[model samples]
Target: MVPYIRAQNVNLTFRPKNRDPVTALQGLSLEVGRGEFLSLVGPSGCGKSTFLNVLLGLLRPDQGEIHLDGKKISGPGYERAMVFQEFGLLPWRTVLANVELGMELKGVPASIRRERASELINLVGLTGFEHHYPHELSGGMKQRVGLARALATDPEVLLMDEPFAALDAQTRDLMQAELLQIWDRTKKTVIFVTHSIEEAAYLSDRVVVVTSRPGRAKKLIDIKLPRPRDYEMRLTPEFNDIKATIWNSLKDELISRGIGDGR
Candidate 1:
């Protein structure tokens, strides 16, 4: 089957003011299957986030191409939507109000936007909190609002960047379960960027490991675990085995960068 999203020989570089140039990505290529849950994991500055941004069309790569459903992606389209770690919600708006903002900007009618937002709000498990503002919600709640807003567009792909990183461990676990449930329901192709090997193993059908600095694909590990994954699965040997493989992939890159063990 043809890949749903394909990146070929991608390269991107930047020059900071009063500093030498830096390459963020080099000869990086990736292909994500339709309806697949894929995660990109790497150490800091591995271009994981940059890859997501390129796919989002917020940044243009200096070279190479990205395609979606066989069509070249020159710019951002409605087929893609993103959820960030910071929970980018308007403090002044209520939950439903924030969720409706995207469609509202697209000129969706009030009644229609309200209807769709209401459904998604419930889908993300924030029914009674529709009237609550961002400040009133907890960190996890705020991130849920962000996810609801991203999905409100009914986009074909959902791009998440360490969105659960800011939450407490318990909340992060809860959100991870919630994310899997939501993905099962929606089955939207997802490209997630995370630093945690455990998170990648628990959430993805496959994990893509990227090398350090001027990142390129180092390895791809197929998560053979069964679907409908939950917190308990982490305790099993199978899960840890996958985690070990990913850890080794990351460890090799880190060691090469002189970030050796024993601090």
Candidate 2:
């Protein structure tokens, strides 16, 4: 069977006027199985988020192609949605209204969208805060609203670009566990871009480490850790081993780019 998502020899370049062109991705290829949670990690500016935008159809590749299921992706479709690191909630809208935004744009009726939004609001653990606006909520709560909004459209694939990176350490960890729970229940095919090696190890079924600049897949490591994961699991030797493996791969990329010492 064909992979649920495939990127073959994908390349993209940024050609800002009067400046030298920067290649974001070069010959980056990978295949994701249906309902798989895949994370991309590498040195900063390695095009992980750029690749996510490509998958979202926000940017067209200069070469190669990406296919969803058996269809080639030419532009953004309702089948995919993204959650950003900065909570992309509208300050003017309440939690419920924001969650309803996607479905609303898709022409879903108020009654139906309201019901679905309510359910998702609850799913993201923001049930009673429906009336609250973005300003009234904490960083984590705003992210929950963003997550709920992303799911409001019922997309088959979810693209997350460091959705919890802004939160405090404790909140980030809590959100990670919450996100896994949501993923378990929804089973959405997720392509997450995160710089945290531990976060990638904890959340992904497979972690893809890319090379720096003109990013390409450097290593694809499978995490064999059991699911229904908890903080206690982080203390296990297996978890640390996985983190170490990913770090070593990413470390090599950084060292190659003169970003850090191997030590």
Candidate 3:
């Protein structure tokens, strides 16, 4: 059977004026099952975000192809929605308006959009804050808004580029747990790009590690931990074992690039 999402032998290169071409992805491939939460973890320049862009149809790969449910991804479509690291909210818009933005753009009826946005706002734990503006909220709250906006359209797949990276440690932890609850409830296929090994282990069904620049898939590690996970799970031997496996796969790329001594 065909996979829900498939990226085969993908490659991309960037050409800047008066500079040598840089390849971001080469021979990188992956398949994500429907409703699966997948994470990509690699060194800083390893094209994790680049791959996410490809999935979002933001950047066309120079070679190879990516498909969703057997359809080639040629450009942006409502079937996919992205949550950027930066909260890409309109500063002047209220949380409810921001969440409704995508559905509004898609020509969803005003009444329906407003109703859907309200439900999503509550889902993300921002029920009362729907009237609040971006500046009025904390980093975590803003991210919740972004997440709600991404989901308002009811996209089949969600692409997240280090969505929690900017939050403080405690908030990040809280958001991680919140995200799992949301995912369990929504069941949208997710492709998340994060540099944190622990974060990847905690959030994904399978974590894909890519090699350094001109990135390619290096290894895929499956998380065997049972779900309905809580913070206490992070302290379990199983979780740490998963972390160690991801670290082992990632450290080789870092050491090869001289970023670490592999200690």
Error of 1 at 158 (Å): 0.3
Top of the candidates by lDDT: 2
* Of 1 and 3, the candidate ranking higher by TM-score: 3
In model 1, what lDDT does residue 222 have?
99
Runs of candidate 2 with Cα error greater than 4 angstroms are 261-263
Q: On a 0 to 100 scale, what is the lDDT of residue 182 in model 1?
A: 95
* Candidate 2 global CA lDDT score: 0.94
**TM-score computed on alpha carbons, candidate 1:** 0.97
Which digits, one per residue and each the tens of the lDDT, describe model 1 over residues 1-263?
A: 88999999999998789999999999999999999999998878889998899999998999999999999877777889999989999999999999998898778899999999999999988999999989999999999999999999889999999999999999999999999999999999999999889999999999999999989888999999998887899999999999999998899887887874621
Worst 10 residues of 3 by lDDT: 254-263
Model 2 lDDT, residue 164, Cα? 88
- Model 1 scores what on Cα lDDT? 0.92
Give every collision pair in model 1: none
TM-score winner between candidates 1 and 2? 2
How big is the positional error of residue 1 in model 2, measured in Å on the Cα after superposition?
2.2
lDDT tens digits, residue span 44-137, model 2: 8989999999999999999999999989999989999999889889999999999999999999999999999999999999889999999999
